[model samples]
Target: MGSLRINKVKYNGDKYYFESPVFTENVILIEGDNGTGKTTFCNLIYYGLGGRVKEFLKEEARTHKEIVNDTNNYVDLYISINTENYHLRRFIGDNDITVSPFTISDVEPPTPNEIETNLVNLDGVELLPVNRSFGNRIFSDWVLEKLNISVIELYQGYSTFKVNFTELFRLIYHDQQPNPELIYKQIDTKSNYISDSELLRKAIFEQLIGKSSSEYYDAIVEAKKAEKEKLLAKHFLDEFEPIIAHLRGAEKVINKPFLMTELEQKEMQLEKLHYSREAFKNNRTANTTIDIALDDSKSIIISDEIGLSESKEKLLSLFDEKSKLFFLKENTAKEITQVIKVIHAHDQLNLFSADTCPYCLTKVERVSGHCVCGAEIDEQQYERFFYTSQEYKEILKSKTKTVSTIELAIKGCEEDITSVNSDIEQLTNNIQNAKKKLRSILDSIDQPIDIETLNNIDDKILSIREQISLLNQKIELENKYEKLSSEYEVKRKAHQSAELIMQGLEVKAKQEIVTKVNDFSDVYNLLMTETLEDCRSARISLDTYLPVINDGEYKEASSGVSIRLMYYLTLLTLSLEDENVPFPHFLLIDTPETAGIELSNLKNCLDKFSNLQSISNDYQVIITTGLSKYPESLANNRVIYLPNKANALLKTKSQSQPL
Candidate 1:
């Protein structure tokens, strides 16, 4: 639906320059003889738009060595995309192109002369690099964006590749290469990132007809991402399934509440065991008389323990205060050193000549105590403005005094810490002694239960506690497994939904392509019948989008050149007729008469090409052919005429003629 029209093409070199006449017609013809740079003109247009020209220049070196050797040679293509003017410039043997917006004082579309004079002063120019490196801004993507076409990714093998503008232009540009059996240009698969396969060809065709939209590709990408996430979740679950099973077997519980209940029960059992052991000792001792002594010993232990805790806390507080004082003292010392250095720098500056002002480099005069600038030079005020050496010394002395004070404080704090440590040690010994006395008082009584029975109870209690801890751990793992399972299900459903939406879009796109292809075939068959000598029938294959002539494949056709020409014309005609087709409404056919077609059939093809203007005047087709081969009736379409190789499309300063 987008429109691209080349208004002018200018070729500049160190010693010569050539500019094409402003293209004001839909069908522009470049009629030139052999070896007259007709193909060079076409290649310049391609190169100016950021197409590769290294291989092209290498092949044409013998014929166009002068233009190649001129290091300052570059081509500028002035074009309008959807009524917005732009200028694209690319030098020979360069991998990048400079694109600038073409604007001239209130002109909707500036003339080529205005562009040439004002292009250098224009703003918003961008340099687009052409390469296949990942994460780089590519030139083709910019062209596609300007053409209002969405770049979509196509799956190739295990990787995905977006269709570049070069790939799309191959279908639009019908070169003079002899391999007419190939529908598209022969892609060098080794160097090219995208392979020349059925998938690519179909994708190109689908894009041209507006089938492969960005929305469709977005859905596909989302579906793939969701599927990947779902698989990751499943993998995690599979890897941890054994661990979950092991936890379940060890805990014998599935939930947190059950584990909590078991833990509480074990704790209660432990408390009961302690109480029973104490009661049994108490009953054996009949210790009502010693109860008071026991109470006093317990009180003493409690009091000593509290005192020990308080002393430890005090020691920690003193240590913290000492650490803070050390940090503050170190920082203050650094500040004093920095101030002294500043004072020394200021003293050094005073050694400079005092007759001239350092800032203004002018003579200085003092009247009384005032400076040359009429500012009072009070010594006390000057000291306030800048740090004086004596003042800095005083500051350093003060900082030293403060450091001494902090040292005293730290010493005091260390003494207090040592005192607290002594208190803590004494309190700990007193508590231990109290506990020993209480134990002896109990041991003096007769034993109510044997030691082996108490040991058995303690072992059972420890086993129950261990079981409770294991149950808690298992409960946490089970909860995690449940959460992961829920996540997996959600991802799986999302992926499935995305897949369905993608499939639906695919079906709708296929239907649209089918309708467009049928329309394309109508024009193609008509052109083939009129242009071919013995053409029985011609139709584009639905699957491959290639022409099939006389019930045979493209390669099987008797005249491949005729089929190729008709194929290009058919696309042009379809684009003009259908507004939905995403073609740029532009075609570049370079020397189509190379493959030796009959003169009558060639003229028929030319007539079909000129007839496109009747459908719509919104398209531009630039075709190169020999002057003698073109019919005389369509002479108005001839925009450029090259008499011979002497007046080629590109000429050097030594040459006197013009194109």
Candidate 2:
């Protein structure tokens, strides 16, 4: 990773102007008492380096609109990343971003300022705009590109998650804001809802230690996604299987009103066919054997008995009339039953106890003809005319008579139909005999079958064909449903396999990362002061990635701030020496001495910063603190000193500037 070192910061415009001393040493401390713009100065360097400050410092920026003297005021940061110097400039109250290469003339602003045609000239400096819609990604992208840092990718939820250098700055720059509960990944401004906090903490640790593999995690996530889709598709099939089966065999035309017209036409045609069959049977009775020659010739008898055609017609008409009588007989029987029930109920009502009214439950004199409630005594007697047994008996008798008459009429019609049938049988026998004789007389003659028989055979064939067509349609639908079901099952199993592979990779990756974290925790303990010697055996919590001292969390310890410094410094120190750990090789810790600690322990903490050169040859550590708090040993490391808030790094319009 490319190393970043902030050299100096300059603010000029309107009525405010101030300049910070050049940062030369590897470990530079900005010392000042409280409210002396110490925090503000550190934050300016953080913001100038494209470090994300909105999440933790948005409220501070909003409250202090006069951070500069005027809205058009500007702050410039002269910094070096990987030995290349650059000046990053920004309008205090605007969205303008500009960067230029370092020049001798750029060391400081001129005494008499020169007016600009636009906000700032882009002749030499590169103008970088903050693209808010894309997460202000443009500025971070440019910084990372210059540093030669590749974009990192990891799996979060169902998507491939991404993080740029701007996010990494949150981990590197420890601001003045105190958050005892959180020690790592405090800035949650990104999409944090999708991943587990514990799992992501481990994942970040893995990434820094060079144990993370984007391809491996992404494959696992993709497989999980496929599995979910397959499961959904399978469930869809299971839910609709019954419906599909019903649809396959369903007779879609059964309830159609349009089919009713066709049914009526078929009924009429069937009736006509029946009439034609009867006519044909009657016509077959004709004597066609008269032409046969006989040995004793006698006049053929022409007796006039009832003609087969007329008898058949009379039988057919009687059958039609009998059907009506049968319906009337059934109707009359129902009416008779209803009337009988009514009469029985009336008789039961008439037998109610003599001197009491059932509805009012009141007593009555047998001969008084009235109840106490004004209800008529013997009320049944007055209502007898409406539902009298005699009237009921009359209606029953009338219905019974009508039923009997209809039955007799139906029986008479049935008798006539039976007699006609017997005569038709006889006529059929006579025709068969006549046909035999005619065949004998015309032994060499050819004969044809009846037209009605041929037409009946054709109609039967058409009906059978229609049934076959319906059966074929049902079979087609069944095949279609089966094919769909098979495809769903195949895809479901494929998704399951992918999910298994993803889970295996995750388990393997976790094992490798835990080993490295244990090693780093040991180094962290060594860097702590002797005061924490008893608890120096503390390790990074595998779950939270925070320091765990003596089986207890470091955040809960009395020297939480000091422990945090050990954790941050150790991580930064490891990043410089170990090729496995990826870090910016830069640190901006606000205050470590503010925590109540012994003077010797405080010196040990400051010495840790000074002692980093032995472990790593390259790194920058910047810390802000009060002058009176830190040990005298750090006096040589003090890069900037602010006596009070009035003469802080950022001079307001009211403060006077030195000549």
Best by lDDT: 1
Q: Over the stretch 572-644, how does candidate 1's per-residue lDDT look in tens digits?
A: 8888888878889999988777556778777777788778767998999988998777766678888899988
**What is the lDDT, from 0 to 100, of the residue 142 in candidate 1?**
85
TM-score of each: 0.63, 0.52
CA lDDT scores, all candidates in order? 0.74, 0.62
For model 2, how does the per-residue alpha-carbon lDDT over 5-81 read when each residue is reduced to its tens digit?
77778766556667777767788888787877776777667666655455234355444444633543556787777
Residue pairs with colliding backbones in model 1 are none
For every model shown, the clashing-pair count is 0, 0
The clash number for model 1 is 0
State which candidate has the highest TM-score: 1
Q: What is the lDDT of residue 388 in candidate 2?
A: 38
